[model samples]
Target: MSKLVSENISTLRPYEPGKPIDELERELGISNSIKLASNENPLGPSPKAVEAMQSLLAEAHMYPDGAAFRLREAVSKKFDIPMNEIITGNGSNELLTLAARTFACPGENAVISDYGFVAYKIVLTAANVPFTSVPVQPGFEQDLNALAAACDQNTKLLFLANPNNPTGTYVGRKALENFLKEVPPHVIVVLDEAYVEYADADDYTSGLELRGLRERLLVFRTFSKCYGLGGMRVGFGVGPTELIDYMNRIREPFNVNILAQAAGAAALFDQDFVERTVKANAESMVLFKRALEDMELKYTPSQTNFLLVEMPEADKPLGGAVYQAMLRHGVITRPMAGYGLPNHLRITLGTPAQMERCVGALKAALEEVQ
Candidate 1:
């Protein structure tokens, strides 16, 4: 065998996604399983998106438009940003990786919260760029002041996941604005609003509202979460046109595939689907919290579709074993060992019946272990 692999990738661990339905079914000889592990929509993809993809299938033989011009136009109009300021990616994950490559060099560094999104560290590691992760506050809230302290001249980017993943905590508009105000001009803030749509804080400011600070912040949004198109992996970033121009240079011409582009554009206008998803997710969150309260279990309050529950016991396959047991009972939730929270699990809020299954399975799993 030839030793041709780059050292960066040779030892790097790839992102391990949750077990699929087929794999679980094969292992346990069970069928008709429900997966809330991946944070997918129980209501399914938008009808508009489905119809759009169907119409575009016949054109699959042709190469996709390199720039994704039409989709950019729709995004710009919807977000009220200029078309030149946007860069579409396969998903927000791709954009995160691309940002590392575009801005940070071999010796430069990026700053992030210690318990933040897994990809922030993964992408930096994969790129061979140094990174510093400041620990969060006791309640898993981002310490923006600590982030400022962590950065120096080498820090090219700062990733802030509002309504942060796994933890699902968010800062109000005033807090974020204050953080941005103190941010140095040299560093670009990547505000990841992947779960912002589900965040119902009255004072929360949409990342789109920060367009005036284009040079200092780039806001990343996904069609995957609120729009229900995770399988297609569609997302975009709005920011400084000059910065986007440089990043777009490194992107694959057809990074956002034709089908995803078409579907995403259609889904953008499917307000009915979005409204229904937002409403159902709100109800599910309340239901879960009430169930946990009744059971006397402790859980973090979340503005997003998922919640982080403190187990205070079990990690990994033990935590994951609990996740497996849940599968056997026709429910699936995500273990957080991979995210360095060995004692916590992230459960996506589902439809009413699905939430009921999740709660029942979780209680049984804990009792079984106890």
Candidate 2:
């Protein structure tokens, strides 16, 4: 069995997703648990998306359009990008994997922020493409300068997550623009903007707005966050036609399922729902920050729908213990141990009431764990 597995695959560590609410309830023998672990849109799916998906339930017998025509059309209209430059995926996760496999050859490698999305390392390694992790700056912001300096001719792909997960830190427009210019021409930059909709920062510029800055740049987005289509797994990438064409060559046929395609397209038109989701996230974020402040818990300033909260010192209980204690209180949060931040937790914003409950649970958990 050992000899059967590829050396790279054998050594690779699997990604641990957040515990699902149902699974937690079953294991803990509890009911009505609130999960703030996976950075999901607390509002759930859009009404228009539901209607569209329901209308297509009868067409389950037929395979999805392999090209994801309707969804691409909607994306194109929404972003003003051409259809040929858009590539759809099961989720943006799949697109990240595809970018790794399609661009990086055996000898070439990719580069990512140290605390960037874990999926980048997973996908790159799984594709047998080596990568370098550039350490984030003091504020947990991706050091764009260091990342640019780390790239050599062998660097084929560079993965950057704006409002990076597990930390919720972002580089502003000017910094991003300067960094893009500094990157070598041969390296293809993959900008993951999954949380772009929630960012109200004045200087935050989506990679979609800077697509013309680099010929090889690709901007990937998902309906999972703001659009509330996590279960449907709808994601799309915008890039030059040539690059997108190359990626499509290796893209799985019917990757975007029938229902997902319908749902994503409808979700695009439901701007009102997205606006409401953003508003709720802002309100909840403020409440959570205020609570954290009152508790003397340090937290990162976030431009997205989640907060990265630091626990007590290493001498005290860390994120894992706190997470477990919180679970006993019927609240599920993401522990940062796996991401090498053993003393921190990543909490997704819910409704204000939910945040208050979460704050109460956190206080109780701290008392119990400490």
The numbered model that scores best in TM-score is 2
Model 2's lDDT to the true fold? 0.93
lDDT of each: 0.86, 0.93
Model 1 lDDT tens row, 69-98: 888988988877889999999999999998
> Which pairs of residues clash in candidate 1, taking residues 3 or more apart in a chain or in different chains?
317-321
Off by over 4 Å in 2: 314-317
Task: Please give the lDDT score at residue 260 for candidate 1.
Answer: 94
